[model samples]
Target: MSFAERYGPWAVIAGASEGTGREFARQIAAQGLNCILIARREGPLKELAEQIRAESGVECVTASVDLAKPDAAEQIAAVAGDREVGLYVNNAGADPNGKRFLDNDLQNWVDLAQRNVMTTLKTAYLFAGPMRARGRGGVLLVNSGACYGGSSFMATYSASKAFDLCFAEGLWAELRNHGVDVLSLVLGQTDTPAYRTLLAEKGLPLPTNWASPVEVAKVGLAQLPHGPVYNWGQTNDVAGYAPNSPDQRRARVLMIEQHSRSTFGDD
Candidate 1:
């Protein structure tokens, strides 16, 4: 069956204004799915909706709302409103508090938790039920390499991604038999506007090997059938356990700490 027949008619992409989320919307629309694009920026979302409609001739709806808001999931659901949303991509997240744990304000951390953790949980709860009831759907959770271990200056960010990783893994097991596919897309540095801006702001150079958002989206979509977890460009087992032995995990943590100090000037 074609992708649309199997998992679509409609797909919802959170964070769809740009980068990987935008790429996902484009690719999914190309697969013949109508798209509901949700993001904080109305301008970019509308532009992307227009582009997708023009390019793919697929119906597109743009929802402009901050996913950090407590009622974001309900707002997205309202926009989707009875559409057979066969695929939902939870891709909206960021580390707003870039300072060290103690240096960051408590409210910043709370906001991060609400956006990264609470939003994902609530959105999944709202969307997954219908997908399961229909018995044909997909959920893709965009996670990061920071999920592999603790990140020094990015402690909360990493922890939130870890939650996503674990959540998707559990859902994969629970949903596989229900005709629902769940995938945790574990990504390394991807070349995106936000990431470039972040590097520029910190005076850090972009890595030559950073994955493109388009490539990441393509790989992630293609690997949905192989999940539980899909580590971009990696063939090794990435399920369960930290991708390292205990000693290696310790070494990796130290390396991350040193990198954090060098990058952020944190102790």
Candidate 2:
């Protein structure tokens, strides 16, 4: 099936308060679908839901959740209840305390993993079974450009995203013939409150060169059911993705490491 046909007009987005998640909500609403918004901050989620309802006339449901505690995943998965979930956009994510690995709070690292990976996994595991039973479903996992070689200061965040990227692909392969379209979006730096907080924590002095959430959401929505992972549009991304062979991929990894050091190192 085509991309549009695969996704239809329904979506559920986590981290829906700001950034790519919010953009996804808007775009999907415009696509003429109802939406479910999940995030810890209910105020913004409610505001966005109201905006989408008023502007796009799409039904919006808000679930204020901190998907980091034990059993949080199961609780989140239970929301679907009797409804068949058509599109699951796992956009919820968190960064570690922004300290170095040695200085970072262990609990923060654990929270990052639970929120970013565990929650997405639970939702997919629970909802996909039903969607597959119905012979249709689309899963959108929001990964990051930081998941490349490795991350230094933001090690936990990067590792969690890597899990997201890999899991999306593996699951997609399993569900393809079953009409399940699983997608992993490898997003670059985006202009959002979360990104701002992270940059401030990292003390990056350089000017921002980032992509918009709208662009990320649009490209992601266009590419699912075809494969697992896709890098969003950005001119510089060409150089990063050009590497194909295993050796070349290694070279690419090294390059990412070098650039990351330069970009994040104290000047």
Give the winner by lDDT. Answer: 1
Model 2 residue 166 distance off true place after TM-score fit, in angstroms: 1.4
TM-score for all predictions? 0.88, 0.83
| Residues 1-267 of candidate 2: C-alpha lDDT, one tens digit per residue | 543355654567777889888998898888777787888888999999999999888678888888787676676666545554688888877563767777977888888888887777888887788778778878888887766656667788878887887687667756876888887777776777776776777787534678878888888887754446677663322445423322333344446545767777622
Instruction: Please report, in order, the local distance difference test score of every candidate based on alpha carbons.
Output: 0.84, 0.73
Best TM-score among the predictions, by candidate number: 1
* Reference-based lDDT, residue 216, model 1: 90
Write the residue-wise lDDT of candidate 1 on 163-198 in tens digits: 987788667766777888888888888888888888
Alpha carbon lDDT of residue 164, candidate 2?
83
Q: Which parts of model 1 are misplaced by more than 4 Å?
A: 236-267
Error of 1 at 132 (Å): 0.9
